[model samples]
Target: MQRVYISDTNIWIDFGQAGLLDALFELPFTFVSTDIVVDELNNPAPAGLLERGLVVETLAEEAVEQLFTLMAEHGNSSLADVSCYLIAKMQGLPLLTGDGRLRKQAAKDGVQVHGALWLLDQLVAHDIVTKAHAAAALQTMLDAGARLPPVDCAHRLAAWRT
Candidate 1:
């Protein structure tokens, strides 16, 4: 079964800035974005995101209330971030995020959360990307100002360098 995820802005930006957004399509996962996230992008209505088949979704009915509740709890987050969480939580789908706070909160609330590192790991595990290529992608993201999870930065960077 294919896993579906509501991807957040940072995750999108990370892949986009790395020029590896197409790599996401190679994975066995479907990604959906919110209107708010689209609006947050530097460009208006990015054609690439749509062309890549990312489903753009809008909050429906009770979802608005749930977004509000998420906002109330995770007040430090943006509307787009809360919206992503709402969609993932409501659909019981995993939330794709690189935001530390959101990841922590989502995990605490039992919402499945995934980050760029996880994405890289999946790509390597599935043989979609070689470890060398994934590591280079990680370096590319870092060079492009992506704030990756710091925990394994040194170790992963070293492994990739080899």
Candidate 2:
């Protein structure tokens, strides 16, 4: 069975902007997000992604309460981000998020967290995309103002440049 991951809005935007939205679903995992996160997406991406196997989950009442609790605790985090963390926690799934605050909080709560670079690495590792393709996409994301870690991006950029 493919592992399911709860994704945050920013990570979705990162993949969408990098033009790897189709490649994202080609990986050997299932990507899911709350409807709240889906609503945060720009028009065409959401519609296209749903057709390509993105799972949209609606939060249950109990989970919604927990989401509120997380939002209050992490005052700087958005409801959508907190929802991602909460859902990942509830489902025991890893979280795909690019928000530093959400990542930090998820770590504190024992939730596994990953960002865009990690997703790119997955694409290459799974043979869903070539090294050169990954490198170009990474550069495109960076060029489009993605706020990924400088050192990690640099390392991947250098290694994948071959």
Candidate 3:
């Protein structure tokens, strides 16, 4: 089975709103988070949504080492995101994120990544939410300061509506 790991921030925010976390349990992937990510979440600022008791946190030394290797390879800024990327890369897992810079960095480093849009797609595909509901939620995300392109949002909305 594959593993799906997330960084400290993005996915938690998006998934919290979309209720994707529940759907994640149905997939054949083990959800994981590193010690660095756990620390970042414990901070008061970002208020990691998953930290509110949704998922388990894994702190393996090997995972930490993999994260450090990816950080060295990509020169990433956030230790949490770097650790998430490294674990996914070394273990052949996919990462869930919504951070633009992190996504770009993960792409450059050949790490598989999924973002908010992907979650929206899954919501629609699984009939978890109606097209209108998904669109409204996505728009809400935009209104709440998510940096999605308007054109891309329109395209996705159209596809979902069809």
Candidate 4:
């Protein structure tokens, strides 16, 4: 079975801006998102992602209440962010988020979290994208103002260039 991963809003924006949305969907995993996260994404992105097989999950009422509770505890996280975290936690799925606050909160809750760089690595490791292609995607993300870790980005860029 393909692994399922829950993605928040920022990761979508990062890949969309990087023009790597097509490449992202090429990866061998089932990508899911909360309804809130899908609603949060701007035009073309939501449609494009859905067409690429992005699953939009509607949370249960109890889960929605938990989302609000989580929001109260982690004030820095948006509703959409908390929604992704909650779903990931409940389903034992890894979370894809580039938000620092969300990452910290997810860590506190024992939810595994990853970002764009990890996704890029996955693409290369799965042979869905070439090393050079992954490098270019990373560069494009950087050029599009993605707030990825510079050192990690540099390390991957250097290694993937080989």
Best by TM-score: 2
**lDDT of residue 51 for candidate 1:** 90
Q: After superposition, how far is residue 134 of candidate 1 from its true place, in Å?
A: 1.6
| Ranking of models by lDDT | 4, 2, 1, 3
lDDT by residue (63-147, candidate 4, tens digit) is: 9988888898887788998899888998989999988888998888898999999999988898888999889888988997889
In order, candidate lDDTs are: 0.83, 0.88, 0.64, 0.89
Q: What's the C-alpha lDDT at position 22 in model 3?
A: 59
lDDT of 2 by residue, 1-162 (tens): 788999988888877877898899988889898998888878336888788998989998888888878888887888888888888988899999988888888899899999999999999999999999999999998998888999999999999998
Q: Compute the lDDT of residue 18 as modeled in candidate 3.
A: 49
Stretches of candidate 3 above 4 Å error? 1-8, 17-30, 42-76, 160-162
**Preferred candidate (TM-score higher): 2 or 3:** 2
Better candidate number, 3 or 4, judged by TM-score: 4
Ranking by TM-score: 2, 4, 1, 3
Tell me how far the alpha carbon of residue 111 in candidate 2 is from the true structure, in angstroms, after superposition.
0.8
What is the alpha-carbon lDDT of model 2 when measured against the actual structure?
0.88
RMSD of 1: 1.9
- lDDT winner, 2 or 3: 2
What is the lDDT, from 0 to 100, of the residue 16 in candidate 2? 82
- Sliding window of 10 residues with minimal summed lDDT for model 3: 42-51
lDDT of 3 by residue, 2-99 (tens): 54555446555555554555554444445576656666663222343344333445657776666666566656447777767666666776787765
> TM-score of predicted model 1?
0.90
